[model samples]
Target: MARQSLAERRRQLTEAAIRAMTRDGVARTTTRSIAAEAGVSLSVFHYCFDSKQVLLESVIEAITEHYITVVKEAIRPRATLRETVRAGFQAYWDHVHAHPGEHMLTYELTQYALRQPGFEHLARRQYELYADTYTGLIEELGRSMDFELRVPAPTLARYLAAMTDGLTLSLLVLGKDAVPASADILDTITEHVASLVGDEPARQSTEVAGGTA
Candidate 1:
């Protein structure tokens, strides 16, 4: 195969690291194991990342991006506002359902980071990414659809992130057998969230055009 750029190589190793961490827990996964998982030499892994901490940071970012991309696409102003909201939630649920191990790894990474000295910031960054992701999605909807938030965008974003975090954790704790029941709860919460917004009148699209005009 041709040579991979440093960015490409880092991405390759990061993906491998995610898989390793997901399968073997953050505490169990090591630079050597990650290198092996990527089918590259340990020297190459060292060259790409300064330390395992850096590698973990990369994995944190990559995994967050992994799921948010799906939600972003899912929230693209669907046929109805409620449908759009449901799609975003469903997209997130689908990811957790399909990759339970990957989703579980996120919680593990957070706990691992918190317990490791000088690594607490990683846990903070992880949740911050969650809020930031929601902030972007909320803003995207504000720019596209007709609605105003019940609270400020940042507030709602964090709330959504926290709420989803709990929901996801409950799913993991309850196991796959509770899938049907969780869907009911998710649907109720999604509708309640949707109800909180969408009270304002007219298209958010026209508001932007009128302002920029």
Candidate 2:
């Protein structure tokens, strides 16, 4: 087999680490185990990731990207603005349902990070990544749909992030209890979020009609 580049090697190790962590709890997973999962030597794992923290961070990012990538695609301009927004949210919800274990591991990783000395930063970073991802998506939706925010972008982003986090955890914790209402819940949130946008063109049209009257 051809040799892997450093970036490729790190990507391989990161994917392997995610599989290991998702299968085994974060506390139980070790570099040796990740290397074995990736079919590489322990030394190769260390070479790619000098510390466990680095590997875990990569896993956090990879998992985030894994779900957000679907959302981004789902958010592509549909015929209706509300449809597009709802599609994005529904896509994320679908991911949570499909990969419940991965979502559960994210919460576990957060708790693990907070308990480990000097590793609290990882938990913070995890949340920050969520907020940042929302911020980007909100901006993208605004640009594509042509609307201004009723609130500050960051405020709206963080609010959405918090709402998603709550809903995801509720689903995971409540299990089947949340299943019946899950789609309806997501639709309600999508409507509330869509309503939070101030549509500039629509407002201008209404103002022009009033002026003519």
Candidate 3:
């Protein structure tokens, strides 16, 4: 077999470190174990990452980039406004469901970063990227639909971003089965948002009629 290039080896080692951190938590994940998991020698791991902190930081950057790409892909331009919103939430749900270990690692890293100034900057920058992407989409939808949203597009975007994060944390703590019924909860919240923006008259009418009868 052809030998893997330096870039390929680094990527492999970084990914293996992420998986180890995810499964074992930061405190438990060791350089020896990460090297073992990657099927590489400890010297190879050190050559690629220099240190465990460097490996963990690389993992954070990789995971953040992957999430941003996924969210962008989910909000493709062809989708309708409602579909775009749904797609964003669905992407969050799918990502967490598909990679529970990664999600846990994200939380762990976030908490760890909060304690340090340098890591906090990266974490904040990642958050700003997420906010900017979602806010731009919301603004575009508002313009296209000519709706005067109760919350400005930027604010709404922040709200939705925070909501999704809170929901994900809830799922992490409460387990998948304990997550509130998706259809009902999302539908109700969406309706409430539409009502605030005076956007979904039909839904509001139906809700009013239901309440009356």
Candidate 4:
């Protein structure tokens, strides 16, 4: 068999670690288990990731990237900013529901990262990535309608990001009983944002006026 390249081995090991972490949580995941799950030897695991911290960090990065991709795909070229935001949140909830273990692992790692400065920096970077994605969308919508969004894009982005994070954590802690109401909550939030940004009718009128001589 051809020897696996270093990058390929690393990717394999990282994927295995994600599975283990998701199933076992960060505190319980170990190099040996991850290697076993990946069908790689201990030596191969070490070669790919020097330590548990490094492996976990890679897992966090991988998961964050996956979520960002999902969110972007959920919003891309959607009918309106409100629809895009709602779709993004709904997609996120669906993703978490589908991968409950991975979702829980993410929350666990977030708490762990908060206590360690190095990991905290990585966590903050991921948060910024999410904020930037949402902010860009909001700014684009604002420009299209020739309406200056009341909240600064970055600030609003952060608020929305934090809101989603908080909601996810709440769902995790409270389970389906508490989270089943999320649809209603999302509707309320959408209405509130629409009110602040001006209604669809107003935006449509502005667009029509801009098109006229």
- For 1-213, candidate 2 gives per-residue lDDT tens digits of 898999999999998888888899899998888999999998888888888888889999999999999999999987777788889888998899889999999999999999999889999999999999999998888778867688898898889889999989998898888889987998899789877875555678888999999
User: Order of all candidates by TM-score, from best down to worst?
Assistant: 2, 1, 4, 3
Tell me the tens digit of each residue's lDDT in model 4 across 11-87: 89999988888787777777899999999899999988876667776787787677767776776545665775678
Model 2: residues >4 Å from true position, as ranges? 200-213
Candidate no. 3 TM-score: 0.69
TM-scores of the candidates are: 0.91, 0.93, 0.69, 0.78
Name the candidate that leads on TM-score.
Answer: 2
Instruction: Evaluate all candidate structures by whole-model CA lDDT and list the values in order.
Output: 0.87, 0.89, 0.70, 0.75
Pairs in steric clash, model 4 = none
lDDT, ranked from best to worst:
2, 1, 4, 3
Error of 2 at 50 (Å): 0.8
Identify the candidate with maximal lDDT: 2
lDDT of 3 by residue, 135-174 (tens): 8767656665544577677777777667777767866776
Which stretches in model 3 have alpha-carbon errors above 4 Å? 115-160, 188-213
Clashes of 3: 0
Model 1 lowest lDDT segment of ten: 197-206
Answer with 3 or 4, whichever has the higher TM-score.
Answer: 4
